[model samples]
Target: MIPALFDRRLIARRRRRAVAAAVPGSDFLVEHVAADLADRLAAVTRRFGTAAAIGGPTDALARTVTASGRAERVIRADVFAAGPAGDHPVDVVIDDERLPFADGSLDLAVSGLALQWVDDLPGALVQIRRALRPDGLFVATFVGGDSLTELRAALLAAESERKGGASPRVAPFVDVRDLGGLMQRAGFALPVTDVDRVTLRYATPFHLMRDLQAMGASNPLRERARGLTPPSLLARAAEIYAETAADPDGRVRASLTLVSLSGWVPHESQQKPLKPGSARTRLADALGAVEHKGE
Candidate 1:
C-alpha cells in the first residue's frame, strides 16, 4: 500500500462539521458541478441500469441522475454519514478509497467536486474501475492544478514577508494533462479529459476562506503547518489579493478549474488504434502531391 498523503480522518471530521453547519442554499458550487456531471452522463448514448455516486455533501448527482432517468438506481457513497432526507438520500457511507461493492457490478460511476482530497487517487481510480462492469462508464470532476492560483500567490507572499518561510497552505491538485495517463494506468479504454475554469468574485479573502471551510476544502495535507496563521499575515495576504487580483468593481477573483474525466471499461467492441505501417495508400497520394526522392 502507498503511504497516505492526506489525513483522511481529518477530512471526514471537517466534512461532517461542514454538513452539520451548512445553511440552506449554501452549496451552490457543489450542486452546480454535480448537476453538470449528471447532464453529461445523460448525454451518453448508453443507458446505465445500476450507477453509483461516489461523493458529495448530499447525493446531488444521484438525484439528478435519478430524475433524468439515466440510471435506474444510484447508490450514494461518502465518508460522512447522511444527515437528513434531502432531494437524494445517501444509500451508503464509506471512505472514498474503500468502495463496498462487488466487482463488475455497476454500470456507471460518477463523482463531483470530491476525490481531490483522497490520499491515493490512483488507487481509488483502480478500485472504481474494478467495480465497473464491462464497458461501464466512469465520469468524475475535481479541482485541478490551476485552482485558487491568486489566493495561493497571496498566501505565499504574506507568509514569506511575515514569517520568513512558508509551509503547505493548500493541498496540491492533480493536473488535467495527467488525467488521461491515470485513466490508462487504471486500465480504462478511450479515456477523455477536459477542463472548465470558473472564476468567482469575492468581496474579500476572508469570504473565500469561509467558502472553502464551508465546503470542507480546507487544506488536509499531512505535513501542513499546525500553528494558527498569524492575523498580521492574513491581513497582509488579503491586502495583496485585493491589490493584484481585484477587478474594476473591487471584487477579488478566485479561480476554480474543474477537470472532468471519463473513461469506459475495456470491451472487445471498442475502437482500437490502427497498427503502424498498415496503411495501403501513402499520404502523398491522398493529398495529390508527388513524393520527393532523397539523393
Candidate 2:
C-alpha cells in the first residue's frame, strides 16, 4: 500500500512484496507501526464523522468500526488484491500522498504504519489537509527515530567489520518535533505531535527480522540494492545485535517508537467573535480602560 518515494515506484512496490517475507527484525518494525496506530486511532475516533485511512487497511480496525454500526468505512485498497472482502465498501480512492477528494472533503484522515516509506512528506501532508473539511481532524502515526537502536548499531558494526564501509542502513525516519510544523504549514490549525516508545522482547534477533518481513516493512533502499546479503555478513550482524542488546532472560529487546501527530482543518465555525470589546464592553468601561491606559 506504499506510494512513490519521490516517484520511486519500483522501491515502493518492494514494500508490498514483503507478504511472504520471514525476516523477524523487519516484521517487528512493520507490525510495530500498524499496532501502534491501531491503538491510537481507536481511542480518538469520536472526534470525526467518517474516518478515512489512506494507506493499507487494518483488518481489526475496519471490523471494529463497522460492527459498532456508527462509523463508515472508506478503504482504499489495491484493485488487484483478490477483490474487496471487508465489512463495508471501500469508499474513497487515495494514493500514498494524494487523495481524489477536493479541499476540505472529509471529516477525518488517518494512516498507520505508512508515511515513512514516502519521500515527499510535506507534499503528502498538503494533500491530506486538502481532503479535510474545515475543522476536520487529521491523525497519523508512523515509525520514527530510536525505532531500532540495537539493530542499527549492530548492523553498522557488522558491516564495517566485514565490508569496511557501512552505508547508513536504518533508513532515515521523521521526528515528532518536525512533523507538527509540517501540519501547520500545510494550512492545518492547532497541530500537535507526540511520540510513544513500545518495547518488545524477542527470543532471537532473527525472529525480529522475520516479523518485520511479515508486516511488509522491509527495507526498500534504492542505492543499497545488491544481489546477495552474504550469509556470513547476516550471521555477524545477528551476533552483534544479540550481544549488544541482550536482556537478562537472554531475549533481545527492540524499541518501536511511534510518532503521533494531529491537526485540524481550519474552520469558519469558530465560536470566538471578531471583536470582543464591541459586544462585551460598555461605554463607561471603555472610557475607564482608556483612562487607565493613559495613566
Candidate 3:
C-alpha cells in the first residue's frame, strides 16, 4: 500500500488556526502567487465566465483574478469556513484530493501555493482537469523542490549532530522536471511549466519559522516527529543556518521557488503536434545549409 504523504486533518486544523491568527502580511507569498496566475491568465485573450480558486489559504487568488478581468465570476474554495474577523471568506469547502466540481463546470481553474501539501498531487490534477470544460485553462503555482533548501539543510545537520539521527522535519516537494509529465499524465493538453525563485531575507531563522507558522506551512508530513520539537535542536539549527546561509548583512536568506503550471483540457480547435514526416521543408533547407548524407 502507498503510504500517506501528509496528514490532511492536521493541515486543515493548522490552516484554520492560521486564519484565526490573522497575522498581517502573512499572505504575501500567496498574494504573489495569485498575481502571477492572474498575469498569466490576462495574457490569454479569452475571458472565462466561471473560475474556481481552489484550496487557497486566502481569497487572494479570487480577488486577483477578478481584478485582472479575466474571469466574470471567481469562486473561492478552501478547507476552512469563513474566518471570524479580518479574514477572507471561502465560497466553497473542498478537499484538494476530492474536488466537488462537476465535469465541465469551470472555464478556468487556478490554485496558489496550496497544492504543495496535497497527499495525492497527480490525483488532484486529474480532478482539476476533469472539472474543466473542453479547452478550459488551468493555472497553478506551488513551491518547488528547491524551496527552503537552507532550512532543510540546517535542520538536518542539527538533528544529526544533536540527536545522532535525523527525522523528517521538512515536507518533500515535487521537482520542476516531473510536473510537466504529471500534467500530461492527467490528460491536459498544451501543458507548460516554469519556475520563479523568490528570496526573502529574514533577520533570523526564528523569524522565518514564525512566518511559516503564520502561513500555515509548518510540517504536515505524516511521518513528522510527534510531540514538540526540542528547543536546543532548533537553536543549533538556527546557529547552523546563520553560519551557512547568512547574507552580507547578517540576515538569513530563505528561498521560495514557485513552480508555475499551465495546461488546457483537450479540444479539437487547439494546436496539435504535426505527424511524423509531415513537414514539407527539410531541416537543412530551412536553415540555408547543405544537407549531409548519413553513412
Best of the candidates, lDDT: 3
Model 1 weakest lDDT span, ten residues long = 81-90
lDDT of 1 by residue, 108-199 (tens): 99988888988788888999999999989999988887899999899999998888988878888898888899999999999999888899
Tens-digit per-residue lDDT, 1-295, candidate 3: 5568999999989989988887999999888887787678768998888999888778888888888888889889988787657476888888777899999899999898888988788988999999999989999998886899999999999999998999998888998999999999999999999999899999999999999999899999989889999999999999999999999999999988899999999999999989999999999999999988999
TM-score-better candidate, 1 vs 3: 3
The C-alpha local distance difference test score for the whole of candidate 3 amounts to: 0.90
| Descending-lDDT candidate ranking | 3, 1, 2
By TM-score, the candidates rank as 3, 1, 2
**Candidate scoring better on lDDT of 1 and 3:** 3
Residue range with the least summed lDDT across 10 consecutive positions in model 2: 78-87
How well does model 2 score by local distance difference test? 0.66
Whole-model lDDT per candidate? 0.86, 0.66, 0.90
Work out the TM-score per prediction. 0.92, 0.76, 0.96
- Model 2 regions more than 4 Å off: 1-15, 18-50, 64-70, 77-80, 83-94, 270-295
Q: For residues 1-295, what per-residue lDDT tens digits would candidate 2 score against the true structure?
A: 5434333454345444543333334443444555655565567636456666655423433443344443464554321132233332345533565557676667877676677767779888988888787877776778887798888888889999988888665667877678777887898887778878888788998877766655555565666545777879889999998888999889998888888888878777645445755776666686775433453
Model 3: colliding residue pairs: none
> What ranges in model 1 sit over 4 Å off?
84-88, 293-295
Q: What C-alpha RMSD separates each model from the true structure?
A: 2.1, 6.1, 1.4
